[model samples]
Every structure is written in C-alpha cells, then in structure tokens.
Target: MKVVIYRVGQNQYATPVESIQSIERMLPIRPVPGAAAHVLGVANLRGSVIAVSDLRKVLNVEEQAFTPESRLLISNGNGYVVDEALDIADCADDAWEHVGEQKVWQRGDQLIVWEDLQA
Candidate 1:
C-alpha cells in the first residue's frame, strides 16, 4: 500500500497515508512532571491536550532546530508524535523485507523497523 515515509534517527518508517490526521507546525509545549526524557511535553490541540515527543530524541537521533517544514504528524488512535513528516511514498507488501541484526519494537501492524542508511 502507498504510505507516508518519515525519518526518525537514521531510520525510515512508513505509515499508511490514510492514518495520518494532519501535520501541524511545532506548537508551544508545557512541561510535564515525571514524564520520560523523550517526551518533550504537551500542547493543546484545538481543545484537547496532546502529548508531544521529540521523535529524534526518542530514537536517539541528533537534535536539530525546527525549520518551517518541521511538523507534528497526528496519528489516529496512537498518541505518539513524529518529528518531521517526510514525503509520502508507495510501498507494496513485498517491499517490506526484514533486515536482520537490528531489533525494533512493533506495535500492532506498525513495524517499527530500522533501515540502514548505507544500504
């Protein structure tokens, strides 16, 4: 199925484009107590409180300044946040080949796999 590809750390991940709500510019976040390090904070989206996380930090990626293109991809059902939502690409089922040696945590059908930049 065609999916939206995005970068986290040095890896690329694709999610079905239909699952994406909207990509919004980085909004001001209020700090939360006792939250994880990766959890940057929370922002009020419309009237709801949406928790924000630095996708780069969560994936142990190098930090960079938020550019005009920097966005927050709100996924339906999942409360997770994405760093910069990259372009949407077409990825068939056969295209998803397993890359050995690297371990990733999968939630439901979402395979959080790491892609080698060198390959």
Candidate 2:
C-alpha cells in the first residue's frame, strides 16, 4: 500500500495516503475549552476551522515544540500535528507486521509505524 510517512521525534509513523485529505504546514491553533488532553485545539486552514490533535501525545512519544518541519495532517476535517512530514512510499503488504495493535514496517535499522488518524 502507498503511505505517507511522518516523524514524531526519532520515530516514524505512516498512514495510507488516501486516508488524509491534505498535508499542510503547521498553522496557528486556537485553544478549545474542555478538549481532550491529546487535542492541541483548533486551526484555521484556508477558510475552514478544524480540530487539531498532537500526534506525539496520541502516540505516547516525547512532546517537543513545533519546528519548521512540523506539519498538519488533515483528515475528515480534523488535523493531526506531527513533528515532520517525511515521504510518500509504496510499501508491500507483506512488509507490514501486526505488532500488538500497531501495523509496523521494518526497513533495515529503521522501523515505520502505521497510524490510522482517520479512525
């Protein structure tokens, strides 16, 4: 399957390319009251306002300040903040292994994790 891979610290994560509506640069976010701990708040993309979540928090990774490479993966009107947007790669179905609840791909010394942000 073709996937868009992104980083969250030293770790890499992937999601099906078709699953996300668009990949955008990090935008200014407005805080939302009574939102989930993982939710970063909301962002205005173009003219649409969407909720944004911290992928680092959701993936239980170390949180860091957004850098120039930080990105927003927009899916179904929701946005997920990631450390950086990596690349779009075609991964074979057999390359993926089910590791507990995560779909993981081991490429040499690096491991790529699959996340269903659309879910």
Candidate 3:
C-alpha cells in the first residue's frame, strides 16, 4: 500500500495517502479558550475553520523543533500537527500490523506508525 510518511516529534509515522483530505503547510492557529492542551487551535483552511492539534501529546513523544518540513495533515475537517512531511512509501501488505486503531509498518531503519483520524 502507498502511504504518506511524516514526523510527529522525533518519531516517524505513516498513513494511507487516500485517508487524508490534504497535506498543507503550517497554518496560523488561533487559541481556543478552555480547549485541551494538545489542542493547538483552529485554522482557516481557505474559508472553512478546522481544529488543529498536536499529535506529539497523543503519541507521548517529546516535543521537537519545527522547521520548513512541518505540515498539517487534514482529515475529517481537522488539521493535525506533524514535525515534517517526509515522503511517499510503498510498504508490503504483510509488513503492516494492526495496533489499536492504527496501522504500523517498517520503513527502512525506522517504524512508520499510522494514526487513525476516525478514532
């Protein structure tokens, strides 16, 4: 299966390309009052407002620096934070393992974890 690999903190993850609505650059987030700590804020995608969140907290990874590689993975009208949008990967079917609500696979030297947006 073809997947889009990305980083959230120091770890790399992958999700089926078809699963996401779009991949966009880091967007300006407006703080939301009384929101969760992991809730970065909301962003205006074109004209629609979408909630943005940090995946690092959910994955329990230490926060990392953001660079030009940083991007937002849009799904279900939400924009998820990613340290970097790596590349497209072609992984074997047997290489994937269903873990919780996510799918994990090996990509070269590291493991690429897939986060389920619907969960």
**Model 2 worst lDDT window (10 residues):** 110-119
The Cα local distance difference test for each model comes to: 0.64, 0.91, 0.84
Q: Can you write out model 3's per-residue Cα lDDT over 1-119, one digit (the tens) per residue?
A: 78888888767888787788999999889999999988889999999999999888768888776678889999889988888888887878799888887777866689778777656
Task: Tell me the deviation in Å of residue 49 in model 2.
Answer: 0.8
The candidate maximizing TM-score is 2
TM value for model 1? 0.71
Better of 1 and 3 by TM-score: 3
> After superposition, which runs of candidate 3 have C-alpha atoms over 4 Å from their true positions?
98-103
Candidate 2 lDDT by residue in tens digits, 46-118: 9999999998898888889999999999988999999999899999989999999888999778899988887
Model 1, C-alpha of 60: deviation from truth (Å): 1.0
Q: How large is the C-alpha RMSD of every model relative to the true structure?
A: 7.2, 1.0, 2.0
Q: Ten consecutive residues with minimal summed lDDT in candidate 1?
A: 110-119
Please say which candidate is ahead in TM-score: 2 or 3. Answer: 2
Model 1: per-residue Cα lDDT over 46-114, one tens digit each: 888887777777667798777666677776522345555676766656655556775343434555554
